[model samples]
Target: MRVEMEFLGSGTSSGIPTIGCDCRVCHSANPRNKRLRSSILFRVGEGEDERRLLVDVTPDVRMQALRANLSSVHGVLITHTHADHCHGLDDLRGLYWGGGRERLQLFAYPESLAQLRRAFGYLFDEDYDYKGIARFDTHVFEHEPFVVAGVAVTPIPVVHGNMRVAGFRVGDCAYITDTNEVPDTSIAKLKGVRLLILDALRRAPHPTHLSLGKALHIAQQVGVERVFFTHINHDLEHDQINAELPAWARLGHDMLRVAIEADGRISTDEGGGGVAPLAF
Candidate 1:
């Protein structure tokens, strides 16, 4: 299956510029320097049958979609309940209503769904309606595999200290975010993937997120043909990191497009895909 994976956001939870800090990456002239929190969009099939699966609806989700010229969606797969990952979900209400209203399918673990319900009370509350628009369905995920719009998805469970988050293995492309360490069980779940997009929050150690070194170790251990680091911070400069990385590994930037062919061949291009940044 040919799938188009778009990086909606590649920045950390704080994002670039980080609200007043004067960092070089935050002030760089390169468009890739402007990033939102980590999120992605998976477009499968073509034409009318095309299915859009959102990895995480970050706070910048609306602008990200707007930047990429995406207006409709099929479902959402949340990694965790972090605000940066799920706050932008409210914007999806517009997608539910074009001429009329229609509910969309939402996939996540019980806890993540609970977080969504708690965070966005209006969507879950039947009594509340925003200009005659509101609807959604929740599919609780266990450790088992499932399908969303005909694409088989395997959930990989990783640890963020005491908490557990579900990373996804969609086709040959596996995406794991906000992870500090991947236990043996999670590693088993991630193995044999051709393209792995794992979290690398920064160069220094973080309490909850993986540093660049740890991320690289996990990528090497997974033994995937190619690896791309995401959830980046301003501490890791794009040019500096890319220059030191092995040919197979890359520091993912905003608007990066990763195409996985039916034969599991992985091809990615940030400059040639005509993919514009979702925001400035």
Candidate 2:
């Protein structure tokens, strides 16, 4: 099966062009410099059998969905319960507006799920009698493989400071974010992935987020065919930083879309005919 992935938002928690901050990258003219909170959309299978799986429910999910022409989201795979990553849980009520009462499937780690339920108790309340609360069928998984909407998903355990989060692998692509380190066991799970979307906050080292240098090293160690860095900060200018990266790796931007085949081949709009440099 062929899987299509769309980068809904690629910015860090604060997002690019951050509030009231006047930095060079924040004031840059490049459209790629503008980013929303980190999130991604995955379309698996084809035709009617195709299922839309969202990676995170960022605060910008409403606008992101509208911009991407998203109609329905079948499931959501959360990385963690950070405000930037899952605060948009409320907006999912809109998706259930016209589609009847079909409950959406939500997959996450136990800790993350508990955080979400605590944060959004109203949405999960079965007897709240609320008319517009987002409805979901929640499922929890640790470092194991499970099926979601017929697509197999493997959770990759990663460490983000003192917190443990999950990254997911679907088909030939793996999406990992908000992490400073990937243990050897997790690296083994990602050994042969063709496409990797990783967290690369900035050039400077962070206690919880992967620095650009560390992200690059991880990409090289994994030896993936393509790498797109996400969870970016304002310290790096899109054009300048991207220009410095090798052809196999580049900074990921919102709205960027790529197609991956079952055999691990990847193609993007910027790459016509053959594999081209990662841009846009």
In the predicted model 2, the residue pairs found to clash are none
Evaluate model 1: give its TM-score. 0.94
lDDT of 2 by residue, 131-222 (tens): 87779999999877999878999999999999988998887788999999999999999998888899999999999999999999999888
Per-candidate alpha-carbon RMSD to the true structure: 1.8, 3.5
Worst 10 residues of 2 by lDDT: 271-280
Give Cα-based local distance difference scores for all models: 0.82, 0.87
**Lowest summed lDDT over 10 consecutive residues: which window, candidate 1?**
271-280
Candidate 1, residues 11-45: lDDT per residue as tens digits?
89988758887888888877667778899888777
* Model 1 ranges off by over 4 Å: 98-100, 274-279
Cα error of candidate 2 at position 178, Å? 0.3
Every model's TM-score = 0.94, 0.94
lDDT leader: 2
